[model samples]
Target: METLKLKKLSFSARLFTRAVAALSVMIFMAACGNKGGDSAPPNTLLGITNCATCATSIPSATAIDVFSAKNATGLAQFANMQLIVSATMFTPGASSAYNLYTGPVAVQGQFIAGTTLVDPAATYGYGNSCTIPAGTYVMQSSTVGQMSLGMLQLPELISTTGVVIRMRVDQGMLYKDATTQQTRMYGSVYITSVNGVPCSSSFSDVFN
Candidate 1:
């Protein structure tokens, strides 16, 4: 009887130990430190067309630290080492070719969609791998040619005049993320103005 009792106690101890270990693993996997909600928000709408080097989607809240979301922190280095971005808008029927712009951008603070009423579809895009900082970042298009304007002849169109052939992020992450960085949000890149004249440019298939 004594031997049987000892065995039963030992088995219970082992079972408890295993349960504790499993709980610890679960905690680590979630890794949602103080960052707000229980999990990331639904803003996964992203389409990247011109990566040129990297071919992986952005890390998920579960895979990487959601807290990593910040302003254009390390964008310059990211643009140089990470991916290049391209954003395009279609022109009217039979009149204009695809209005395309490309560049590498950085921002501080991670951006979540719907958080800001400004852009809800996450139509905007960005590129690069460094931490984002709070400020503006510019990406220049290496290729810009007009099918009609005799190519290169009208440099001003794509030049500094209105800053065409470029993608710019004026303080990415329009809305600030929770200090905890727990909630995931969506974002999009739409041109606010063009040709020295502020114009709302609609965008499609924006790649970051």
Candidate 2:
């Protein structure tokens, strides 16, 4: 089975499971207003590789290669969504294909909610990982049961948005901050428009 990974996300979940109370308090703080802290700063992810042929270990310190790119113009409305990542979150290894780790370790990225898309040629270069649009959906996730099905399991994204799209990824490590210990995630994800139309085939992105 292909690994259905979300490097930073799964680790966040694992951390929460291990320290439910403390994590819960942190979540509460986040909900209340403390957006950034030493543990996990706001909007940071370090996308490095695509989870293909790589060492099975994470490095100690690394810079974030935040994913960025312009949205495909298939759907004109696609340009109004957001795509924000800390440009710091990442994990070490990722499978070129799906290969569940049975634990934390997956490729991931997030689309911001407010960032609008632009003609790559008009402003930034045409293919930089800096213009992924914020989609009109909820989130991207998979259940253990669905992971067994194939490289991807988007029962939720499909059921909610009624469409699917191709995705891209890169593996790397995330540096929360100098004071906080860094956790690795297969950071970097690029999404495609479904049939050149907004919502024609779409998938919600997790907050990177």
By TM-score, who's the top model here? 2
Please, what are the lDDT tens digits per residue for candidate 1 over residues 32-100?
A: 333233333224322223222212222220111121222222221112111122222222232111112
Off by over 4 Å in 2: 1-110, 118-137, 142-166, 180-186, 194-208
lDDT of 2: 0.27
Scored against the true structure, residue 83 in model 1 reaches a CA lDDT of 18
Per-residue alpha-carbon lDDT of candidate 2 for residues 1-208, written as tens digits (9 for 90 to 100): 1111212233367443533443343234334431333222225433324323212332332322222222222231111111111122332232211121122222234323344433233232333222334354322222111222011222211112423433433222122222232221223333434323332112322222
Model 1 lDDT vs. the true structure? 0.23
**RMSD of each candidate relative to the true structure:** 23.7, 17.1
lDDT by candidate, in order shown: 0.23, 0.27
Candidate 2 C-alpha error for residue 25, in Å: 25
